[model samples]
Target: MRKNPVFQNEVLGAAILQVRSGRARSRTTLAKALGVSPSTVGMYVDRLIAENFLSESGVRQGPMGRPRRLLTTLAGAGWFAGVEFHALRVQAVGVDFSGRQTTAVVRPLPAEVTADSVIKTILLCVAKLTEAMQGPLLAVGLGVPGLVDPQAGIGLHYAFIPDWNQVPVSSLISTRLGVPVILQNNLRAIALAERWFGMGHDLNDYVILGPRSGFGIAMVLHGKLVEGAHHAAGEVGRWPWPLGGGDGTSQELHHVLSAPATWRRLAGVSVREKLPEDLRAALVEFAATDSAEWQAVCADFARVIGCLQLLTDTEVFILHGPLTALGERFCESIIRAARALAPALATAPLKVVPSVLGDDAGALGAASLAMEAWSPA
Candidate 1:
């Protein structure tokens, strides 16, 4: 006997997304967009409707005589929870099968949030959101600020949080919530969100440079994430920098790119202010100047990105975190520096942009992973 899978999961995923995106509402439109036979589309559509993943919402009266039936995803079929494991706070968001977010809440952890307390906080966040779900909460997606061993169901090393080394995180959550849990590095999680719904969606090769707590990088080459051996591909902090290197000085890439450090280096500027306007103004001042500190920061940025141009050859560079406070002008400077560093290949395909989804990126990425687990065939 021989068995071959129908291989309809990709089709099912595409159909669900097309309906949810309002791009292909009718079976005819879906088949045309997906470039599949009408019968193939009908088979999946009928199966999805029968399984309650889709519904005949109504009919759309087009310019022609006949009214076409419109289809929409059944948002109540299943739900997902996304949790971001921050050093000071844990945020949770609930998203439905139709990719609509239902709720989000952030719980502030106490000073020195420990591994045990982190689990408790996650449970609390999940409990708070699960109470409102109409359908089964299928899975929980977590984004921790550390390395995660997904196979071992453990968080390998939490950066800012204490005593999180080698903690059995997923097992703890699964025992409580009774659902599958997946964990990823926080920045890596955000990169996944960008790939699906943010700036990196259109390009096959791109890099996410989030120079925040630490200068981190995540790449998508040939439309797949470059998670290297030990799943530590984007750990750029360990790489040597600046054609002329440093001894943990201001010239070093990681030190110069640190968000709070750069912010503090701006003399007489403080993010702690009476209004957000004040902080934004300070950020603008940092970008609008040619001060020695600002130039040094840009130089360090150029060195790292220049090396990156040779390493990844990606087209887009996405800037987020504290540096984005300065806006697109700052990003432009970094792009120019990269071009100058590689004069021979001066015409590289490069576009520097900021993150669109902002604060919800981590949780949304986790939710996407959860949806992947429950996707229909």
Candidate 2:
């Protein structure tokens, strides 16, 4: 792809992602990464400077020739928005050029939501958010649960939200808002948030799991995201299981472990809002208690982590979603269970941590996707 003629915007935007990732501080380094000469980088960077996307930070003495001028993004020069809809709720978060969130909104969804309703709610959320934007809105990222074809910007299918099938979410949003858009699975968005803004930023090998709402994973290996065939890499939650049979067949793990579904069943009550920490803590204890159903859930969770450990030597595993509300002790409990049943990999040195972003991870992650769509690396 690099050998082909790259569009000026794509080439420049990719450079911006590199800069934001702290991969290059000077055009010389960016040019090296871009496989172009320093003069060519200067030519394009000057244009970026004119656009207020890049600015001269200072100078760095080059190994040869004159000192190299450092470049940086101007904070708050622009804004991006990310909207995540999952567990029958819609959340939107807006971030400035520096990636700090400036505004956010969350709305509960009705029991029976259709495509049109999802559309209306999303538009309303975006409208409310942009009203507070201090800079131009560059793009929006829409996050949904289940299979997504990012290149096509479509939600291919959703087990929980069947009516959402084949929705061209990106096109609709872009047409309505007059800006670019990116559509992705909510879990992948969470992973990107970790990569760019959260705990996994510095790690090359890590796994992110959200078992509560649904089971999904986003893995970064050697500093690159692992998106399997057709961007459906993280749909492990949908894999069929035969409960302890290990005879090697199972059905959607999400039907039982997803937080909203599981909570309703175990608590014997419906929750209209996010579960309180105390109630969440109680649910944790209940699930950890000695019962076939609860024990099986923990065992299955461990088996899943064990599968990941066996499949790849990921160094860190971060659990997002309701599992986070379970607290660190429970998070570590999941890790311990996995390690106990783990295959004999020479060294599994893995640690499980709770998501620091809390309820905001999804929205912020969506916003991170918007930023990436403009400047993918």
Candidate 3:
């Protein structure tokens, strides 16, 4: 069978509009942007409209003469599901055509969430959320907190969710739910969310780093997620550091910079205050420059950032998860230490920003995956 070049062009044109500003462009405008004839652009728009990928919203009155019909992508034509599996909980959200979330649910599990239990909980959540959907779901996106084989939809290793070795998450869920599914690393999902709608909307290169269940990193280069050959590109937690041995198999930094780890190292200190309050207190106490424990944690964070700088050469590094939840002060301390370790890089002003998406990144990324699947054809 032969492929339709016009249809393919239409899909590309629609995707460009969908991702750029979510606004519809006229045939003349599209032609000018795509360097094609107005007639060709009209044909593409007509096909996309016929496929229900786009619709004529109304007419725009130009200065020249008659009003021209404006076409918009139909965001409500279908829906997709996104899920994020974390150590303590599984967060799921449903997104419709316009990239608006329809439903969101979070299910907490034991510290050790078994494979069977995780699947069962996810199915239950899907059932609860999709009860009102008018038709079959389009696709599903799952984010796991470790290495993943995206092509096979399998989780190679989830350090936080032990016993998830080589689990074919996509096939298992697709079999039960009867829909296409995609599996990705949690950190990669975070980077995707940022790239699609968050701080990374304009930037072409950046990195997201922090301690979740364990430390993780995700990079966006040239406006695309840089998943390596085996889909384990940004696994920077294993990088060797001065505080840890060079074997590169230890979770030394995870244990030193994590929320619970930081609190444990502080002995009697409590992080019960709100994020802002906690940050203020930590900043004042650390400013005294006498807390050996605080200094050690900062050093560990700096080591991670230094390695990330040398590796990805990303200008913007976003910090989040339990560590940043402790407060802005903690994040500031890490940034300060990171600057000290790499003086030259700091002098050029490496932006170590906090995560803008927070806990919602996973669900949003999942939605984005679904959107990509259901995009115009």
**TM-score per candidate, in order?**
0.83, 0.84, 0.82
Candidate with more favorable, higher TM-score: 2 or 3: 2
The total of clashing pairs for model 1 equals 0
Q: Please give, for residues 1-377, the per-residue lDDT of candidate 1 as tens digits.
A: 11234457767877887787677889889999888899889988998999998998678998887888999988899888988867778888898878778988789899977999999998999899888776988788888776777667788986688688999888899998888888777777777778666876567888888776667888888877676789777878655554455665424455546676567665544545233324435566677776777766766677777778777878877886757777777778777877876784478776677777767777877776666555564
Question: Per-residue alpha-carbon lDDT of model 2 for 1-377, expressed as tens digits?
Answer: 23444576688887887777777789878998888888888877887788788888777887789997787877667899999997478999988886778999888777887777887888899999989988788889887788888888898887667588899988888899998899888887888889878998778888888775677898878977787887788777777764454555555777656766556555655546455544456567564444555455566677777788778778888888775665676666666777677656335676778878777787888899988877522
What lDDT does each candidate get? Answer: 0.76, 0.77, 0.71
Say which prediction, candidate 2 or candidate 3, comes out ahead on lDDT: 2
- On lDDT, the leading prediction is 2
Q: How far is candidate 2 from the true structure (C-alpha RMSD, Å)?
A: 4.1
Top candidate when judged by TM-score against the true structure: 2
How should the candidates be ordered by TM-score, best one leading? Answer: 2, 1, 3
Which sections of candidate 3 miss by over 4 Å?
Answer: 5-24, 28-37, 59-69, 110-112, 132-135, 241-251, 266-292
Give RMSD to native, each candidate: 4.2, 4.1, 4.6
- Candidate 3: RMSD to truth: 4.6
- Candidate 2 lands at a TM-score of 0.84
* Global CA lDDT computed for model 3: 0.71
**Where does candidate 1 have its weakest 10-residue lDDT segment?**
271-280
